[model samples]
Target: MIVVIDTSSLLSLVRYYLPFDKKGVLFEVIKSKVSSGEIILLDAVYEESKFVGQKIILQKLDFLTDKGFLKENKVITKTDELIPLAPTRFLNMVKNQFVANPFQLKKLNESEFEVQKNRFMESADAKLIMYCQHLIKDNPEEEIYLVTEETPSANDLKLFKKIPAICGILGIPVITLPQLLEKYPEVDLGFS
Candidate 1:
């Protein structure tokens, strides 16, 4: 199984779950998942995370990203090489799916298509969906899940959709952090 994650979900880990454990249970559990290639974060989401937090959140992020950190001599995380941006067949997949799924880019005129494509190329939400689709196409038997802390709101329209809202539209399985932990009950982090 594979999981595609967004910035909000990672932030939720830092701000919500990790706070309950000064001993780094949650961090090690997630790091193990990442090391095992089960959880992949988009490059855009990674870049966004470094700058999108308040001071406390930023400090927590720093701790997560810090190299000199240690608990029982364990590393914080080895996520530096996990970005899927290089040799991104997913980019082509995104373009191909653009005309078909969620937004229906084919329905738009050339000018509008270009505008939408340019905008979506940089959206982490779109990257998450595209990564899911890309993996499904490459490996038919894969059960990929999209993870996000986002919930749908009334303004979650077709063009400007968030991760959870868009994943629903694209028929991808989306789950919250607690739901994900429940799905994999063995990965106990000492909290729901």
Candidate 2:
């Protein structure tokens, strides 16, 4: 259960919005995984937390790092520039739809698509995916989990599924933060 967490799950847990528990179940799950030697976090994901300014999330990341639970994989390098190329065929279709008529306007300006693309380009998702892909390339059967809450865009769910699809091909597990809580309720999940 080498779990790779994204910021959304962490934020939700800290805000106590995703789950009804005030015990900070999300934090506990992350910590529990680390304590059990099963969690791995990308360094870029850690860096993303600084933008959040949430003391609790930062503390939890630090705590996990101190315990050697989080791994600094796919660290963002200075030379690594953001390459925001749209999906070849996907982009063409979107463009064609936009050019065709005004009826598809709502679908064109989808927030979900923008969020995912932004996340892929500048956030932890890209780093985590690259790291996981490398891990799979080397050790095909290694188990990894991607912790995130960003639902796939209605139009791009299939593209979003590529994350899990890659994981599935590589025999990894991708679960949301809420799912982790459901599975590991006994773990100490609190942020004080």
Candidate 3:
């Protein structure tokens, strides 16, 4: 299984699941999986996480990158063959969700919402979806999962389309931190 993790999901793990007593066990396991090429950390996610300035998150990410576990963004050379042109239906859905959602506008204001929506269009979430699609295209037998803490809003006017919603639209498999933990129950964090 190749688990593609995003910044928010990684931060959630660090903040909630990482054991205080056995400091590096969970991180080490993640690092090992990443080093073995079973896990993926996109370059964009790494850059965004660096700016978050959380000591533990930075440390873990640094360890992975330093150990060559972090991967550079995969360039889609045959994008036309692999995916539809820009302003695709998925892209339009993202844009429409942002534009029509009054809650999003109210919270971020029009200007700020536009900025954030643009950022989302270009950054981690979008890249993650593209990468997952590429992986599925190239290796249909391989199990690929996107790990994110983002959830869709029950309210009709959701300000932002979370990763799961986007992934659903793109046909990418998405899981949360708790779901990952539940699926991999053998993973010992030394919590006891």
Model 2, span 1-76: residue lDDT tens: 4666677777776666434455655555555565555655555766677677555576654564453333333222
Query: In angstroms, how far off is 172's CA in candidate 2?
Result: 6.3
* lDDT for residue 31 in candidate 2, whole number 0-100: 57
Question: So what's the TM-score on candidate 3?
Answer: 0.71
Show pairs that collide, candidate 3: none
How many pairs collide in each candidate, listed in order? 0, 1, 0
Report every candidate's CA lDDT: 0.64, 0.54, 0.67
- Top candidate on TM-score is 3
Clashing residue pairs for model 2: 28-189
Superpose all Cα atoms of candidate 2 onto the true structure and report the RMSD in Å to 1 decimal. 7.9
Q: Please, what are the lDDT tens digits per residue for candidate 3 over residues 46-142? A: 6677776555687654664453333332311122232323456655666665344655566776578668766665677677777787787778898
Candidate 1, residues 88-189: lDDT per residue as tens digits? 553454455333344465567878866876677556776677677667667778888888888865353454545665566566788887777676655665
Error of 1 at 81 (Å): 16
Clashing pairs in 1: none
Best by lDDT: 3
TM-scores for candidates 1 onward, in order: 0.67, 0.53, 0.71
